[model samples]
Target chain A: MKAIALKLCSVTGMKWGIPFVKLFSGEEVLEQLKEIWGTVGIPLIAIVTFLLIWHFGAKQIDTSLGQVPGPAMVWEQTKALWAEHVDERIKADEFYARQDARNAAKLAKNPNANIRVVDYTGKPTYIDQIFTSLKTVFMGFLIASLIALPIGIICGLSKKIMQALNPMIQVFKPVSPLAWLPIVTMIVSAVYVTNDGWLEKSFIISAITVSLCSLWATLINTALGVSSVNEDYINVAKVLQLSPTKKTFKIVLPATLPLIFTGLRISLGVGWMVLIAAEMLAQNPGLGKFVWDEFQNGSSQSLARIMVAVFTVGIIGFILDRIMVELQKLVSFDKKTIA
Target chain B: MALLELHNVSKGFGEGKYRTEVLKNINLSMEEGEFLAIVGFTGSGKTTLIKMISGLLSPDEGEILFRGNPVTGTSHERGVVFQNYSLLPWFTVYENVALAVNERYPDWTKETKDIHTRKYIEMVNLTPALNKRPAELSGGMRQRVSVARALAMNPEMLLMDEPLSALDALTRGTLQQEIINIWTKDKRTALLITNDVDEGILMADRIIPLTTGPNATLGPEFRIDIERPRDKTELNDNEEYKKTRNDIIEYLMDMGAEVKTKKTTNYRLPELKPIMPGKTFRKRKEEDKLKYF
Candidate 1:
């Protein structure tokens, strides 16, 4: 049972829990305590030290708006943001209830009274913006993967294809999201003619920009991974006389999965970074836009709110990376490649 | 027609000043159900030769034939067990074997394939580790899995490239016996490559030596006329086994010496005397005299 729990901890990137589990099992108590201190206690102390530093440091800095908001002010802003979201949700519910009552009254007064229920069009809350950012980033990441993985595999398989595409890949890899945003915005505006389409134009622009900037890491890493599959494994495939497709899926892909997941982790991180920049630059409705708007608002509380968004973005990025690590661990056979 | 044939086959690598002829004029033939072993020193193009027969590699100058047809590419008809085990690390023992079985008998039902895979795994006595991945297995067990995978394909011919060399002595002996037992059951055409003369003589009906490289080729073939089920202990007493083993060893040693002589280069030596650290030679002699007194 302890072994299973330890394995679970490693697989889920919850390695901090391992020492606790081991401590509970009462084996090598001193060692477990040391491990617990290293994994959990040290990190806790470090966080406390950082917060104390930030709290003291804020008093020394004087910006044009005011002194930089400390941890306390950021916490207040976070709570304020959550409270505003809750208040907006309550208002929306009341609006819906009032409309439903009015519709029922209209129907009772006259059997065929023309009654229409309009959709709520309230400004998005901070939580709503966070979801929007997540959705946008995921969509962008999916698009990048869909484009990168097949091309990467083909490039890995055939030298001629790689040679043909290498120059373009090199040229485009270093191009920033900032550079792609305007081009993507123009193209999206010209191509996306429908105003009432399922997707919003701003959303599409941000997603496309993210895809453009994020695909390179996945492409390069996957190609490298595929090309570097062990020669012995390839020989085994040949001995079996597997079909081209079967050989690729069975031997090449499985062998290169660790590297591919590494590429994906990098790609998702790039996509998330690119997504925020794109959303901010494009004035799209997401956390990036929220941050930018708060900066422009320049109110005393706006700086603290923007700091809250910064922390949110950083934490979300960390969680995304951790998720990819877990997925990589689950798929990869080689344990040494986990980190 | 021979089960397999190689005619005037030569293979090399690189080009221009860096070119090397790794194998040259390698000619061999095997009839149906023949157990042939090619013994050679390390880096003598043994693996290169086996790969050619398995169709993973093509000879630069000559063609390889199987059953009177020109060999083109790898096929399930010739299954190879590589030197490094080469079991896919991601796959369990069962999956590693099942992969080949599935590819060979694609039309078979899933259940049938599973049974066939399990049978081969059990043949290698790996039923306990059926679900264990290659990374989890020991070197010997991994090689067993490799052997099982090759055998599960039901190939007409089996090619093994130093499959047991990575294993410990005890494991190597057990796997060697298991392999022989499997080979003798159907007597499928088998080719085993190794540097060990005893391994060749014990398992092969015919043993051939591969000379040291830079144009390594097959030397004279020795026929192992001993009866089947040749026990390792009894082989020590068998006159024929001793004669064949000595002859092969003598021939190999002579070739090794010849190569050493051909490649040897003399270098001038510097005259230097050994001295104890932190003391002159006279001081050391004085200390030795005092210690004796």
Candidate 2:
């Protein structure tokens, strides 16, 4: 049972739980106590200290509108956001139910009656905006990965290809999402002419901007990873008389997966950050837009509400990074490769 | 026809001022079902020779013929066991072996491939480690998996490049005996590259020496002529084993000495005397006394 618990903790990247499990099992009590203090207790104490500092520091900092929101104020705003989301959900449900009932009645009264259900046009809540941001970032990250991986692999395999792409990659890599947004907006508007496409133009613009800003990380890391694969493994592939496709998928891919995952982790992070900035600039419907809207509102509670969005973005980014780490650990053969 | 032949084959690296002829005028041929071992010092182009034969590398000067046809790129017909175990780290022992089996016999059913993979893994005494990845296994165990993977391909010829060199003595002995047993069971054409004379003697029907490099070539061939099931302990006491061992060692030592002499550069040194620290301190003290006076 102790072993199982420890294994579960390790697998989930919750290594702090290991000492607790070991302590419970009555093995090396002193060492386990030290481990617990170092991993769990210290971090908890640090967080509490940070909160206390923030709580005090917030009272002194005054912006043009008001003072910065303390932790308590931010907490209150978080609850308020939840309450708003719940109320909006209930209203939406009621609207849909009423519309369905009226449509049914109309159909019953006249069998061939032409009745259309009106769509709910409610303002998106804080929670909805968060989901929207997540969706957009994922779309952007997916696009970036798709573009980066093949090119990266080819560049890794061939010296000539890598040489050709290196300069372009260097030039584009440092360009910010703010710079990309205008170009992407123009191109997306010009090329994507359909008004009733599956994706909105603003969403496409934000996603494309994110992809443009984020893809360089994945591309460079993947090429490095692919090129640095152990020569012995390549020789094994050769000795096996494997086809080029088989050699790549079977040998090269697996060998370079850890590095590829590192690249992906960076790409996803860049994509998320870029997506938010793009959304803010483009006034797209996401957390960035929500933040921008609250800033423009200039109400008493607006500062706290924006503070809520800040914490939400930070926590989500951390969670996304953790998710990538866990995914990398799952696929990587060596535990040491998890970084 | 010879099972495999290398005629006037030479390989070199770089060009112009930096050219290094790693292997030159390497000529060798192996008969069907014969086990040949090439014993060379480290950096003596042993690996280069084996790689050329396995078709992983091309010879610059001459052709390598397999069954009277010139060898081209790598083929499933020639399987190689590398010095460092090259089993994919992501794959378990079973998967590593299965990969070779699947590639070699693509027409075979999955069940047949699985059975074949398991059989070779069992041969290497790695059945218990079938689910273990290369990282989880010891050096010897990983090498065993590498051997299993190569054997599972069912190649007409096996090329092993110092496969047991990294292993501990006991593991090396065990693996050597296991390899000999497998070879005797179905005498496939096999080439073993090693720096160990005893290993070459124990495993091969004929042992050939590779000269020291910068332009290394094959030395004299020594037929083991020792009886099969050659016990390592008994070989120490055997007259023929001692004679053969002495001759090979002497030949290698002579070549080593010759290379050392040929490559040795004489440097002229300036004659100088060491200054005594105590004398220098006394001289400083005398000068201080004079200044005080």
Candidate 3:
């Protein structure tokens, strides 16, 4: 690094000493020369800039109601928080044992008074929220795929079906999943035939609402993509007298893959986005609930911790998209990998 | 009985708002192992006629029979080689051939399928590039792959819709010879749609000059009785071959004259350009002149 700086200094001195001669000489020589700084310079500059902002810009947030802690403070708290977490784990065991002893003691007095009387945190654990959110998103995505793929294929195959469905699809597509949350919550509350508790049914309703809102883009685009396949190939399939099943699998599906993949990527992104918002509105036991609860509590590190969750979400979503893209490249037949 | 017969087959496009007859009372028949070339104007329904025989489409006004069976939809018995690139873009030369091979011979094991598909690939002299996709292949190589694909199907009848017309002369000549070689060995019922007179003479047993559409029909059937395994380069030197060549040229010339006389008096234009023979466009101008009859 010192050698590089010295070299640059010498070059600059040379450039200053004889402007015309040095300028032309160095310009002509180094113009075509590959420089290490030239290759890695931009990214290095960007990383430095990002670090500076992350270190300094976070301090400027004028949050009045809740104190948004600095990165260093958060790091310190995070470590202390982990120790507290261990302590909490032991406390939880103690609490459960205490409940058992209390129940045993109370059986002699009155059995009803021993009915699980204990202090409730009324706040979600980090691990439970993460697991809950993941399960809900996975279930909602699966449900959406099952319903959308067939309808998409049908609309793709037949023009009349597309024409008939287009109006309804268009109408429902733009309405936000958040908009559907309240209606779904109400409907389920009214007609959940299971004698189960009211609270249990809301999660199912929220998932269905998220699915209906986020899944349309994939289905509509997939159908449109399948329809956009070259007419000649369809005729070729016809010329082969290929069975309907064969035509769908061999001809239609392969032709529509690039488009279908585009839809899938977009749907997954939308589904994840909708899921967070839905959980917030419904007070569901998920990551969204954790963020909302922290916000309401007005903790100093609440915003910083939420920032961590947000960044983590963004990183995870990016990785998921990249995985889909990699899978697409692998399955695609048109591209040749000499291997 | 004719191996394939088209009886008073007439076809038209659109109706009521706009109706135009493309073929009128088209009558033709071909025996088994007899090579027939149907030549015509571009939109003269030559392809449509062959399609009916191959069962790509049905004639609305008449009956087309393949050995007395009514033609309907696509039948595997009649295999077709289309002019434009019809080889699946995604499949390799080997895979393209294997598609039909595996379908036709499903009882064969994977090893057997590989062997048989390879045999046809070698037959077309495309073995080195068998693993290459259609996009990777040259025009001639792709056409050879198409030929291999059609042959692999092992159909009773072969229909070619100007299969070699897209190629340059050198590539065209090579594929024509390969096709003739394949034809002589199998002697399947073959129908070729072409406007190249020399190509017709070289390959088909009978050349049926298709008068150009909007109402194109067979003008005449010229017999090509040159010996089996006809060498393309040598045929250009034979006496009988020359006679047949001149006869076709004369017919096409008269057809062009007829086309010239129908609308305008510009029948005697100065030698603006040297007329290229055996090209489909020059031949199509002949049928386009059938304005009156």
Leading candidate by lDDT: 1
TM-score, candidate 3, is 0.74
Residue range B95-196, candidate 3, lDDT tens digits? 778878877787999999999899999999999997898888999898888888888888889889888888898999888988888888889888899867
* DockQ class, candidate 3: acceptable
TM-score of chain B of 1: 0.91
Per-candidate DockQ values are 0.74, 0.69, 0.34
Tens digits of per-residue lDDT for model 3 on A1-339? 444544454333322223233334555445323343444455579878886777787667678654456567666655654566567777787888888887888886886773777774634456557767777776777778788888898999899999999999999999988789989888877888686564456578767877887689779977997788776677667666677887788778887777776677778778778888888878878877767877787777777667656755676676667666656655565644311
The TM-scores of all predictions, comma-separated, are 0.92, 0.89, 0.74
Off by over 4 Å in 2: A1-8, A24-26, A94-116, B109-115, B261-293
Candidates in order have lDDT scores of: 0.91, 0.90, 0.76
Pairs that collide in candidate 3 are B212-B287, B259-B289
Candidate 1 residues B142-242, lDDT tens each?
Answer: 99999999999999999999998888889989999999999999999999999788889889999999999989999999999999898998998999998
Clashing pairs in 2: none
Candidate 2's chain A scores what TM-score? 0.94
Per-candidate iRMSD:
0.8, 0.8, 2.0
* Cα displacement (Å) at residue A170, model 1: 0.9
Residue-by-residue lDDT tens digits, candidate 2, B1-293: 88998899999989999999999999998999999999888899999998898888899999999999999989888989999888898888898988889888999998888888899999999999889988889999999898888888889999999999999999999999999999999998899999888898888999999999989999889999999989999999989888998888888878877886776555444665646997899779756533321
